[model samples]
Structure formats: structure tokens, C-alpha cells
Target chain A: GEEVAQTPKHLVRGEGQKAKLYCAPIKGHSYVFWYQQVLKNEFKFLISFQNENVFDETGMPKERFSAKCLPNSPCSLEIQATKLEDSAVYFCASSQSTSGGHNEQFFGPGTRLTVL
Target chain B: AQSVSQHNHHVILSEAASLELGCNYSYGGTVNLFWYVQYPGQHLQLLLKYFSGDPLVKGIKGFEAEFIKSKFSFNLRKPSVQWSDTAEYFCAVRAISSGSARQLTFGSGTQLTVLP
Candidate 1:
């Protein structure tokens, strides 16, 4: 069984401030994914990475949101100038590999972000 | 664009009652389906998944799902649910393709509240 870990289970920030979240995927897992769950309770894909390379970021906000998955460091998702709209629970997920057709993902306990 | 639809937003049931959660996807190509459960204040956990196999798939905690290809649906079912089964259920899908990036599209979750 894979276990994904996330840091700072709760975060509170003021509008216009910066917010950063960290995720450590299961050991040996190469695929990392980020998602945002708003008050509406829907999980929205934000970004995904394969190893140290970004695979898909279609759901990411281009101007203020950025994510990275370095080799030795934990994957990070940062939001510059946080807004009320950015207040949501951010979740991290991981999978072993994407080469095969089927890869089941394991999710981490989400980081709850509250922007005042 | 791929999307998942969960028809039921809230379901209340007594112990020993049958449970069914509807999940439908909007993609025509090959895809992988998943059902996840989120207990109160906990992270999302995989309940079951359907990749490629028999149309009927069984998962942990006496949960099962059926993949109806022609209907483009994967519906979760439990013959008898318990109070501990009260949680939020999410349905997700990922397009299966070699060249495309893999990201899960989750549905608007269904909240199950089981009474003892």
C-alpha cells in the first residue's frame, strides 16, 4: 500500500499573501498530482508531475500558481498573492508509474487553506 | 474534455440498507474508473477501481462496482451498509492513452449518511 504525506495540515493566510503547500509522495512513486477542493466539495485537478518533469497543468492558474517536483525535495505547490477564491483544501496524490495502461492513485490528507 | 457526473448529492440510509451511487463519465475512449471515500476530517481513500477486466469489480469493505461500457457508467453498490460507512463518495475517471497525460477528473461527490 502506498502512503502519501502532506505537510501543514492547516494554513491560514491574508488576502494578497503567499501560500505554500508540500507533499511527499510514496517512496518509489513517480507520478504526483495536485487537486483543489472548494466549498462546493468538488475535486479540481490543478497539476501533475512525472518525476521531476511536469506532465499536465491544465487546471492551474497561469499567473499565480506554480508547482514543482524536484528529485530530492518534496513536491511543492505555491500560490502567490492568495485570494479568497484560493481558500480550499489542497490534496496530493501519487502513483507508481504511468507507462502501463492502469495506475491506481493514492491520496494524501489534504492541506486546508483559509484566506482571510 | 473528460468529466464525471455523480447524480446523488446526499443520501440517508439506515443500517443494513442497500446503497447505490451513480457515476457516469463523458468520455468515449478507453478509460479507468475509480471510487473514493472520504470520512469526516479525513483524506480521500480509494474504495475501488475498474481498469480492464470483468464488468463487475469488488473492492474493500464489501463494496462493489459495475462497469457498463455502453452506458458509460461505473456505479458503486453495497448490499448492506453500516453506520461506519457514512462518508462522502467521489467518482473519478482517467483517460487511458499512451501519449496523453494522466489526470483524474472527479465528480461532484455524494454524501452518504448512514444511521445506526
Candidate 2:
């Protein structure tokens, strides 16, 4: 069964509008990651969180892109002022530590955003 | 910065044919390699992974990948592929020494279309 869940399978936003994406991590998973796939191919890392704290955000565009994972709430990725280039598929994934030392991340079905 | 490369941008094959996809990475340190598959309209799923020990690792759906340390390559292989296997394949690498341990660098994905 798919553990991770993403809302709004499809979104349409105009340029300069705010676009928000949501993701719910798998139960018991401690890590969350966000990625952007543009042109239906290349995947670019956006950000990652360990629990409610951010672990790494080097890939994020600090200007307009911001993401947050808060307790008792679904993780969210927001683009302040969307541009035509922001139209892409957003994927969320979750992972938890295990005895094997390597825990594989499981992904959500992704949200497709179309900025016009 | 570490990066991954998938040689084939797109691959088309008839059912029952053998399959191979090349993946190379540029990181001069211990790495964790992974092969992920995304079936049409489905979330990304782990096909196989390699951390250490054996150079060859087997995964679900008759998929296998061999990691060659000297060449910095991890190529996916299958003796026979089915039409249901049509999907996008991604190669990802995580450098163990990269301080930000959980960040994954993904390659431009290879889309595999298995014809019936």
C-alpha cells in the first residue's frame, strides 16, 4: 500500500499567483523530502526535513520557494509568486531509520502544477 | 557537487526482450546507489539498491543492478521485460561523506516504453 499521500493531483495557477502543494508523510517516518520534475524528465531536489526541523534546504530557491513540516500538520511547499517556469510536477517522499542502516524513501504519486 | 548520469534518455523495447540501462555518478567517496521506477500514473518505487558488500544486488520485478566501484557505474538489468514494466527509471546517488547525508542527487530520468 502507498504510505505517502499528496493532495491536489493537478493544479492550475497563473503567473504571479501563489501556488501551494501539500504532502502527508508515511506514519512513523521521520524524514520528508521534496523534489521538482520539470519537462516531465529532469528531477531537481528542493528541500528535506527531519521531523519538524529542516535537515537540508540547499536546493531551494530562497527567494520565492519555501517549505515547512510542522507537528500535526501536513508538510507544505509554497511558491510565493509563480512563474511559467514553475509549472512542473512536485514529488514528496518519506523515510525512517531502520536497523539495516539504510532506509529507502517511499514517494507519493506527486502533484502536477500548470502555471499559465 | 555530486551528479548522476543516465545514458539513455528514452528506450523502446518489445516484450520479452532483455533490458539494460546505464547509470554513472561523479563522486569520489563512499556512495549509496539506488534504482527507482515510476509506472504510469504510479508513485516512484524502489527497484533496487546497493550500499556495500556485494557488487550485484537484485530487486523486485526481476530487476537487478551491478555496481562497479572502479567505473563509478551502477547499471540496471533484466533477463526479460514485460509490457507492464513500461515506466520511467531513475538513478540516484547519495554520498556518504557529503555531510548532508540524506540528500539524494538524481539523474535525468530514462523513460522506458515496453511494447506489447
CA-lDDT, candidates in order:
0.93, 0.90
State the lDDT of candidate 1 residue by residue for B2-103, as single tens digits: 989999999999999999999999998999999999999899999999988899999999999999999999999999999999999999999986433488
Q: Show the lowest summed lDDT stretch of 10 residues, model 1 chain B.
A: B95-104
TM-score of each: 0.97, 0.95
Query: How many clashes show up in model 1?
Result: 0
Q: Using alpha carbons, what is the TM-score of model 2? A: 0.95
Which one is best on lDDT?
1
Classify candidate 1 by CAPRI docking class: medium
lDDT by residue for model 2 over A11-116, one digit each (tens)? 9999999999999999988889999999778679899998999998988999999999999999999999999999999999898855555767788999999999
Residue-level error in angstroms, candidate 1, position B72 = 0.7
True contacts kept of each: 0.70, 0.56
Query: How does residue A83 of candidate 2 score in lDDT?
Result: 92
